[model samples]
Target: MPPRQSPAQKLAAKLLLGGEWAPVTNKIGFVKRPVDQAAVEWRKWVQRSNFQTRDGIGVTEHQGTLTELLSKLLPLGYGTRWLLLETANPEWTAVVENTTGDAHFQYVLRHHLSEVRKIPTIEVQDEPKNMKRLPDEMARGRWGGRNLTVYDEAGFRRSLSLYHSEPWKFHHGGEPYDFEDVEQYSAPRALDCFPHETLVHICRNLGLDPFEEDFYVPNGRAFIVELLHDGKRSGGKKYTLAEARAGHDDISVPAVDDPVIGNALYPSGSGNPNPDAIFPSTGFESYARPTPWDRAVKEFEECLKRYSSYPVRASFSDGLEDLGIIALPSLSSGGTGSTDISVMASATLLESPLAIREYTAAFMILQWRQADDSSAFRSFYPNRKQMAVIRRIYKEQGLYPFDAGSNEVYFNLAVDKMIRSVTELRLTKELVDWEASQPAPSTAEAAARANRSCAWDIRMHIQEREDEIWNPELDDRA
Candidate 1:
């Protein structure tokens, strides 16, 4: 016969839930040792069982579905526990509770699938620029100035080619060229129709190098025009005649017959001038042409004009309210407050649309706060020296000093002031009602009553005064 099982070995039993071994706890109770012959026999038979078992201490069996086990385990904080089990099987269910500790584990058993499903493929388009990675020297300036010096020769070449393919031409009357027939003429041919000498004069007036090969070269004329538009020197200063002359010497020109002279030979009609008749036999290329800053300024102005056309309205409330919360059915983009308290208020107001307003407000507040912190005023503002100013403002307004660390100090103070004003107003109204209810008194008493009424009026007026110290109108326009 098999050797008699030890007390520790006989009590061990595995817990299962949905055909899977589950982690168990024995915090509830402890196991009892067998005393009689029948109890001992039962223990011995249990030890000989084929199922997996732990050192027999405290284990309880449970019977339930996986959903039921999860529902029980989730509230107990045993959701992340790992469980051990024997052979995998389906259509089995059980729940095992441990009596050793206040912790329990759950497990599920399932058959492995034979094949895996293929994931869908996706196509990605190439991105133009990663603005974050761009170096400080290469980055575009706030007012729309582009520093093209970061571009390599190849990049510059590609840009020049693009520029030439769509040359901005000028008509005989000095108006900008609007090609009625763009397909029939090359960019250089269209540009050649404009008076070259007149362009040279305009270049001089703009403080640009009129003699630069890039400025005269038919294909590269567009680049020179762009530079004249920008009005900046290579060193980023306002372009002067001296600077322009220096730049004119720096540009490299390819040897080719002048396109303007060649185009002049092509006459139109019977001695009638036809602007579209111009065409060059050979194309010329000019290199190292810089874009003009003026062109960028014009484009920015146009963008601002278009943006201004969009209607935007500003609304204010006594307390923070999300745009979504208002009963206005026409609101498309919702607004919310910057903080948690604001978020709660927004939720009450906006109901289902609170999420959108909360997101928008958070982003806007972050952007504004960042801008404020980064401003020059933050660095230059007097700290301790300004304490006197703050104290004066407080004394004049009869306001108590608040802790600077409090985030809602300003908002709370505003609300408190409003409440005080309302209370004073009600008190004054009561005083008036009392005076009206009383009978006419003696001269001295009447005089005393008048003084009391005037005092109340003064007090109410003081309380109703608005705080204008931090008004926006005080900001410098310059």
Candidate 2:
């Protein structure tokens, strides 16, 4: 519970908010506070920031006691704070625009808890508000004239993912040209689109401290705020947190310690990779928790070769012990939880010829990791020709990802049966899920896993195998 705010303090809070606070007991406000606080770190941060002039939630009759006197919601722990709230498009746009992530949201969330619930609302700004200069940062953001119209973070990444299969050359009949040839456009590194990276960027730009564990946990005390509307925002277009993850994956998200639902959170690589681009050891990751597997077709697409996808030349299979990656064949593809990372063949992918085959092979391995019966997992995608067949069946036969385990013969056979046989599918899953899956968490783990995968019989089977390709035209929709 928050310490009681007095009548004067309530009035001051109203001044701080620049609008009316929610009626305290009615609890009309949303279940909030800690999430918004962790995401934006507003209520206490403004109180603590140093400036010759300041306002809202922090100013006091007596100064110098910033840490001891505040709420106790945002507790410090690994992978804890970001768990409080899920973000969508509207919230993303707002945080980019102002100190408070969303004023409209703040309005909806006012008077939301024990301490925050009591603050009075400011009906109108004093005509002399300008003289106060920095009466509050909220005033500057809300009234300060930086209303955001869109979240540009999702910009053009889809173009990158579709590069190979859906080439600009094929789409518009234009001559071969790179994505960079377009005016006023430059591609963002895979790191730039990452959800966690965006949050770190926002905090540093605000001149506020980043959520690097030590700095974020102590001042975080807004957990008492209830979750209102089931964590969805009111009156917005609502691009889901999942969509953001997809867009980021199409561009960038670093490797986590675990390929799926990582036990450790350090990034293996990032988009920008500058000293600044080097991700903080601790911060928020908007990546959604791993979706549960249907458990039916768990061993769907196992393959033998593992390698660094970049050059498409090196194989880790022969020498897993050298790399230090432990073998988990004790856990077969079926024994392990799936990696959600999927990469698409972006429109601009045509420009990078080398990545085409590499992307195709890696995409297949990822699908193998996640052997769900979802429509996206029903087939392998080695090329555009194969993807076309899957998409056609998706439209004609009515297969959807959410349907998971229950769909009639997708083209003519039940989806799981199709997976048991070799077939081609579309490149629809995001690279984030793809990126997240390729970890040993340690080189030793990678080596050991490879060792298990290629153990005696498996190695003999690989030598005995002939590479088979399915021609989509051969499928008479049967």
Candidate 3:
């Protein structure tokens, strides 16, 4: 007899609306909120299971609907990036993505049929500059960031002889392509069209629509596990790469095209460069090109705009009313803390382009706490240095320190100002870091300029989001 199926190894699995569990096969996953609800937890699961090397994952959902879902899944198998889309899709799973606003693309892949493709494909990017693999870079000729490559996946493989669409044209891989074919100007003749158009073209060419609802096996078991790791997600303090190195006491750099840097970071012959440096993609690939901090702030603002346009589907209760607190929704991405609290967990911004996930309850409790009266936080999470600042701010500002009688609105405004100063304070500290990296200044004038050289501005993260004080007439911006 076949060995009995060991009771589906007790994973923290569940189904929507309490669907029954059973010994299952043909497993697939639906990641509705991978970053917010699942990043750490799902990553932990993958670490334990080595899922990428074992069971394959696919984007069975059509690109017509699962647009953002496509971005979140890239990292699951060695590919993860917003910029890496054009290449990763065909090698991993096919995806179609089209979004309004900036940072957009229309692309698809059929990793399922990648193994079956007979013709080889090519992709040259703007920057193999952002990867740890130089060998891969040297192999895939740099297209000076501009490239014309064949679209070869399991579902659609073509050998188009080039007819000049722009500039000088060359024969398709040296052979003249037929411009006389009736369906010559086909949709997605290249990687420049929507998924629907591509699917239609594939339908005409391959005679199948994998996107049909019936194409997916019914009752594919679903799971809804409470995220196993909920501690704040944060990168370490911002420092130059030269200081974060493994040896030399510390230093680092994001390995890009520079061969010496790549060799230094990955050391030639190191087996399959570590995939943990940043987002995964073939242990290579640049997704989401690094934008300047100003652009990042714009991204954060756009994120806030789209999130309220489509609020998260997770279940949560603010507990603000219970604490008698109020707040404004102004927020920025990244973690925040009340320096006064040393032991209590602080709030953080979940990083994603599609949504903003944050712990606002901490901000609520923080918003209205009067000096010496916030025993809920102060008594349990006292930090001498941070609380001392709070005490000083309360006393020096000529503000009410102990009274909580109808002063919450005024107190919150005071706290907003305090956070503004704190944010400035945070940026101001960067000079110290800069000094550590620089040689001792020979002249006082140079020192003065260096003191003023903090490259970052206040993040404008001077207020809490998602928690609120509901006095309508007080702040019009709110």
Candidate 4:
């Protein structure tokens, strides 16, 4: 419980706030402090006033002690202290112009806590405000002419102040890109359109951190995409098709890690090998150097040679592994493997260019599926052309015998059945139920358990296998 304010302190606060504090009291005769409400109004008024002069919040003798009272008070929520300090100190007054009063107060509070509750230097300047004459050691930011720079005994900057005036790039998992390209304009607008509260809700649903820059927006987009494409009514502000589509478009494209390295990491081995380059500890040297496409083709051929005689396993863990395509959540001891040749065959076909494209497209489509909506799983809906593509690709790889139409029929049935199974796995309540059954030691442990059982994690695992199969450059053998 907060310490009760004295009548004198309450009157002083009311004066500092510029009006009567409409205090709320319960039937038990407990008065609820009007700090939050007062802070809001006080902030608005302060924004419109010149707070640099001494005649700011300290207008009256009682109000003059407002800052002193705030400094002594507990449970005022940083907002109240911020409101008091914004007027009491010229530096903080300048801080209010660039950032929310709450944010500036947080920085101050953080420093105070870091120093074991010992306050940093707090000086009152009676001279007129002049930006140019401010000391070089003063900590300030570029946005507002307020420098709050504090130095330690070694004359080193001690505060975590953000001073850059450069425009921040809108990043999901990478550095901000120039939005001059017309096609790229949709992404930022989509981000701006969604309310912060909605983003928090979506992040919560996705089992993602609401405050993490990389996790929040990307995962929120996925949840939002399901809402939009499933024709379900979204909570909060309703968005148009254009807004939803733009958000979906932005979300669908995978963010690469370090594009420069991504593009150049696997350049042709044309340069002379470094004499000092350490050979494998196992005494192995490069026997062959194949391009990603070549390596993928070789892996597919090996899969055909090994698994074609036997039926493919329906369990992804088994089928993919047997086909020399390892994925996440390795066998995990005693897991059953289903013998579904077509699905195994499909995994083998990933090395094929057409198969890669088809698989990627299907995964993207599956990603949009809502757990409750059957219509969301329309990505693998079989068609004559798609079936033909699968058949032709398999035949071209020599996995299917020439004139063996029976194999084609088996492939179609297997693929359709596999798609249904995967969809069920993704949408089923088993993972959720399993997670709910577990006892966790802490909130963090519970969150980790939730992430492990999340539908998105499963989907990403499957997607990762596809990525490995498609990019043979990542294969250990390659």
Candidate 5:
């Protein structure tokens, strides 16, 4: 089984973001391993200064003394401080540059230093025994001109002396000064003036720094200040905090009348009778409904019926025959009966050539059947003669072969041959059976007996031969 992960490992896995750093409550910073070159350089720098690393804690070598390495490094500008802090331990350095630290720095520069500078310069003596020290370094400078202050060790130390002054009072005048008076003469304030307390409030509002961590305060303070500054400005009206809050309430509050109810006086509920009601209060009214035109409707119905007519399945020959019928010229009524008959015959003859052969065969079969049923050949001679004449005329016109003589001969011969064949095949067996029933002892009877015996023997021999020839067992299996 695999090993179970520790709670800390599980948390670390879940907290892993795409970036190289772990987010802390105070600020965002990268993690630097002890073996990293950058970390080594930072360790060296810290060691060279008044700070030391002991048991994972960044301790000052001068312990309890006001001479902190970071305090000395702050005047060099925030960027330098940030770089050093990040290099020292990027994972934990956020504690210094966060919103809280930012605000604290701002308070020191803006409020504390501002108050200190109000002290008289003449009273800011190096020897405290002779004269009282000024609250800030600006007071220690020569009177009445813009005095320059360096960020080096001497300048920082001098600045510290001013900070150390009690209530920032001048000895000669016995007067105490506030931060406002001192800020008037001070240099431009640093961008990192976020206060720690303000940062805590901002973090709480954002729900990010619930632990009130000191490291994240500076970052939160800066974020808050930026948000406030960048917020949309009210057009012309300069709004106080109270006024803005009141205006927001006014915009969000509900109106007095209920919009769901139907009330004409109040102009609510779609300005009509209630939609939930089955019928309006005004009741129902009647209006004329127009009828469609009868002729137009009938014509449309007729067109629809025509379009829906049953489809007939036809071959190409059938379609061509139909086209011929549609293209044919119509007959006139002025002609005699014979002329009309001739014209009709010519038109029928011009119809599909394939259909004509089938129709002719059917007509011949019908005539033969009629002659057999009625034994009235003489009476039907006129019709038969007319057909023969027509056939002869068609043959003469080069429409068909002249085969009337062969047809008559073949028909007579077929009648006689069919009678003979049917009598021989069907009646021979009955005749033979009748002869076998006669008495014996006479010459005729003996002749008949001999013939019957011969026939029986021949039949028996043929049956035996057929049995041997068709035997299934005689066939080869292989």
Candidate 6:
């Protein structure tokens, strides 16, 4: 028998018991206490209960499906998938409100895949140069705008090689030498055919030290000819007689059989010491022997002709718009701004192709706003009139204070001008309508209008006159 229980103990034990209340049976001749009865009832209640299921937590069945959807939807993880989802169904929030997280994910997943699929692979544009970590000079101006001094002699020589050699062959290493193989007799040798006298004359006139100086010549002809002259004067050979007349050879001295004077022309009378050999030997290499100099000059000049051109800033001309580059399509006479479609199309050309990404992004923002029904911009968008104003402003003023260096600023101004034009049109319309309704005034009234100190003063006087002449009842004033 359990210990006899008090009323308070029985109540406490009854409270601890989990299941419905039940009457306890007593064993024959042995009376059971209330606490023992309660214990028995609690044990029975525990036996009847079942374990709770592990749902709505980690690694659940729904999570696997959701993960699958996420993987399928975001294979590349490119672009704003949510914006694309919003585009597909504006009321997508309501559609998924009562649904599971997995259901909502599936809806987004389907829309994302569909959106990405529609975008042809060819439509993907390369990221702009300005977006990346480009060199300082690359972002400065057109390729031609870089300073000439940026190239050292070695770099210039390499660039020049591209002009003389087949560029692909030189870089990729083993294409046949073909046209640049100057060893062939029939191959066009520009310097070899050039008049020696004329070449020397040009070199001298240009203040060049044909034997030792390196200068940037604009043409290959000049380059090859200059080098030929240098070769002719390589030894102690003077370019002219002592009296300063133009001639190729020095023949004033006698001949000798010395190995140092090997096979070279000397003055008459064999076996006499050669006076022409007065100069020290410059090894076997002469300025006349073509090795490095002629080749260097020819290649560099060819490169200059092939790779570089005079830098040109675009200018306005007939049939070409002077928006920035002079050779682009014109935006004059409300051309691109004549309609909403045209405005959207033409705004892209306002910036360079390399810098057009910002303009594209801004234009997309406008598009997104119009697409969203809840957006304030949907009703009061500044496309047509703003574009018209932009066109008019460009035609009248050109791109003021905007040039190659300020592309981002130019894009901002274009958008800002569009917004300002919308408000300007609204105000100008009000002013015009107000002016039309007024009675014809005397010359004194006209003079008074003209005599207003400023535009603000003029506006205030006009408003005062309108108030004075107001027929409140007829004008619908409430």
Best-performing candidate as measured by lDDT:
4
Better of 1 and 4 by lDDT: 4
lDDT of 2 by residue, 287-313 (tens): 211223212112111121332111111
Q: What are the lDDT scores of the predictions, listed in order?
A: 0.22, 0.23, 0.24, 0.25, 0.23, 0.21
Off by over 4 Å in 4: 1-104, 111-439, 444-449, 453-460, 465-478
**Model 6, runs deviating above 4 Å:** 1-377, 400-478
Over 1-478, each residue of candidate 3 has an lDDT whose tens digit, in order, gives: 8554221111111111111111010111112122222233233332332112211212121122222333222211112112111111222111121111111111111111122222223221111111123444332211111122233433223322222232212222222233223343343443232122332343323322223332222222111111111123211122112222221111123322222332333222111222332222122111122323334334443433321321111111122122222113321111111112111111112222121212122232344343444322222222344334434444544443523322332343344343343233222334234324545544332332332211112111112221222223323332
Ranking by lDDT: 4, 3, 2, 5, 1, 6
**Candidate 6 C-alpha lDDT tens digits along 35-84:** 22322222222122120111100110111221122222111111111101
Q: When superposed on Cα atoms, how far off is each prediction in RMSD?
A: 40.2, 24.6, 25.0, 28.3, 55.5, 44.9
lDDT of 5 by residue, 262-366 (tens): 122222101111211121112111111122323332332232222111211111111112112211111111101111100011222223232232222222222
Taking all chains together, the TM-score of candidate 3 against the true structure is 0.19
Q: Quick one: how many clashes does candidate 4 have? A: 6
**Higher-TM-score candidate of 5 and 6:** 6
Q: TM-score for model 6?
A: 0.14
Deviation from native of the Cα of residue 43 in model 2, angstroms = 13
Backbone clashes, candidate 3: 22
Task: State model 5's lDDT.
Answer: 0.23
Candidate 2 off by > 4 Å:
1-447, 450-452, 455-478
C-alpha lDDT of candidate 1 relative to the true structure: 0.22
